[model samples]
Target: MGLFDSFSQIRNILKNIDLAAVHKLSQKVDLNKLMGTVSKMSEEDLAKMLKFMQAGSGDKRPKPEVNGDFYDLSKTLSAEEKAIQLKVREFMETEIKPIANEYWNKAHFPMHIIPLMAKLDICGLTYKGYGCAGKSSLLEGFIAMEMARIDSSISTFFGVHSGLAMGSIYLCGSEEQKQYWLPIMQRMEVIGAFGLTEPEVGSAAAGGLTTTCRKEGDEWVLNGQKKWIGNATFSDITIIWARNPEDNQVKGFIVRKDNPGFKAEKMEDKMALRTVQNALITLTDCRVSEVDRLQNANSFKDTANVLRMTRAGVAWQAVGCGRGAYELALKYTMKRKQFGRPIASFQLVQDLLVTMLGDLTAMQTMVHRLSQLQDGGDITDEHASLAKVFCTLRMRSIVDHARELFGGNGILLEYDIARFVADAEAIYSYEGTKEINSLIVGRAITGESAFV
Candidate 1:
């Protein structure tokens, strides 16, 4: 080969090799002599030399596992708790991850997976009795993270059933009500939905519920609409929060799906969490018997208790969504090449990843402590609200960075980062919005009411 052509091949091989290895080789050998020797070599010899250097370029060491738990917080769980976490992780990875994009694209919930999820026996996991395992809130937080790591829609579905719906009954139901519903709901034989958000009232639901209930004889007549009611399309019962005209206090009722005046229409054309069947529910004089009333939920304070408990789970879901996107982006960078080397090796790409990991690790630690407070019975509205606000805000940034790493392909569903980006929007708004949650924390810190 000509000397110029040989030099060109040598430069190409060096570009593909690790720079550190080449620097070490330069220290041991004379570059002028090396170039002269290379100029004399045949094409077959040059190929063999290129292959040898590539093999010696430190590529033989196994790549580290791409775990999003940068801090290894899962190691803090007990052996049994870790086992349960792994079981849920396995279920999500095996059953949900494969079909996440397809179901999301079609905007249809995989009904068959409900039975499969039931087999996991995770519903009502934290409650003390009535078919529950009485697990710790920390473990429950981990479970929430695991579910959203695969698909946030499934996480939302489970959170609505186990956290909001069953939590209402567990916290506000009478002895008789709890005996009848908790076990069946925990076993997944019957599903539940939470109805609190109304057509016009969301942040002001504490005092401005348009859904009204009037008592007459043994039944309460409910008249209003509930918007963005998750799982209401197929839920057997919905925990409806309405204002009582008698005392102007919000009350909770277990309204059955078969109630004559109750109707739920599937909300369509949602850009996010499409696999979740959110419903626009209408209650035209919905008659719920007084027997189904949550006897303990006489006011909005009781409803706030349920929200306070579940908001921590929502924060955990944000962590899961961020973790999923971060891991996906990290994997993509390592495989996607730019110039010559993988994009992951680039300094700019590494900076984005480190920033994402910093935010994710901070979120993980915050929620870990939040669950500890909950388990210790010290969790407050402000505590949950802070995590909800911070984690979700960070989650949006993480998903954005993830999508940016994918460049143009980020918007494609086939790439998977697009789903995370889209789903992050829903997570940011649900359970509580940033402004509302920030005000909750603000009220707690300053001891001054911010609501007008």
Candidate 2:
């Protein structure tokens, strides 16, 4: 071979080598000696090597981002609101994305992020007074979407604390209770959890109230097992709902974790949202002071008020999960080569992307109006229920399509789509099952209860 041909062969081989591995090799080997050897190469060979290195090195096409807000819903926010939305997005991307898979794999919560998360000052985003931002419901919905976009488990954790638990106090607590809890919980100085679903009950929570509470003197005695209480295992306080056996009315109590009778055993082997520390709580003779009771929560009607508010947030979360999966799949298909070109160029693949985007856009628009209804004081139980029902069902379909696009990698946790897919099932089941939410809407539209 000619002198130049030999150098060209060496340069071709080097061009295909992984730069990351080459950099690591240079670190361990004598770098000076390596450069010394390279110095002897001809100017022509050197130029070829440098050119090939530049072509194959780390610079890549700008990564396709995972955003499902196709209609520019974010543009509707004011400048200040958009900045805050971006701030939360940046936090989730930088802090949570790196460790999310590790924590989810181990089924452990990263309590260390609490301080960092609290700094966002988003815990009580929608309420007025007591250190809250008093933001619009649309902004709150956007915040929920941003959290679930990166990790649904984290979103669930936030919603349980901010929406359900703190919301119980906001809507149902007395002035004294609100003054004491809202400020700290809003700051996330004290994490909270909602304890409503029970071991014997899941969907029929409103009427089935199996957990019982009885008043004795100044304290109320609570006895019941609450299952799937997200964040309950470590939350400082959990809002437990139990039926007043005397009146057959449901009431809410703030059960502190330190209380002797409030026992929380971490549930094990969950397939989805593993990073969320859900617990099977045994409130055996749990003693709660009347002062801790939610003074305004008169019955199941009151609990529904809280659910009616938070269910809209859950629908927003479903949009986030679907966005994560759809973005992953879109990026994957665009990069994955088959038949000598990117699969995303294929018609069928484009069809799938279109389908996923259609569903996502529909969800985004629905929740946007749902928030408007809430902000306008026109939101009803059935309105929230319908949004939850439609969004979650569509989210399941979107995730399934995204996972199918992955072929084998869809089930692998490393790809992140698997996490979204697994978490979608939990989102589908929780807050309220599709059947129940659908029945709620059915009753509203038909003026007939189909629940029985």
* Top-scoring candidate (TM-score): 1
> For residues 1-452, could you state the per-residue lDDT of candidate 2 as single tens digits?
45466556556656777899879988899967976787688777777766565566643457656567778989999999999999999999999999999999999999999999999988889999989999999999999999999999999999999999999999999999999999999989899999999988988888897999999999999998999999998999999999997889999999999998889999999999999999999988999999999999989999999999999999999999998889889989988998898888799898999999999999999999999999999999889999999999999999999999999988888999999999999999888889999998998889999876
Question: Weakest 10 consecutive residues, lDDT, candidate 1?
Answer: 53-62
Compared with the true structure, what per-residue lDDT tens digits does model 1 show for residues 1-452? 65566567557667877788778989999978987887688877877776676576543547779999988999999999999999999999999999999999999999999999999998999998988999999999999999999899999999999999999999999989999999999989999999999888999999899999999899999999999999999999999999998899999999999998999999999999999999999999999999999999999999999999999999999999999999999999999998998999999999999999999999999999999999999999999999999999999999999999999999999999999999999999998899999999999999998889
Instruction: State candidate 1's TM-score.
Output: 0.89
Judging by lDDT against the true structure, name the best candidate. Answer: 1
Alpha-carbon lDDT, every model? 0.94, 0.91
Taking all chains together, each candidate's TM-score versus the true structure is 0.89, 0.86
| Cα misplacement distance, residue 181 of candidate 1 (Å) | 0.4
**Lowest summed lDDT over 10 consecutive residues: which window, candidate 2?**
57-66
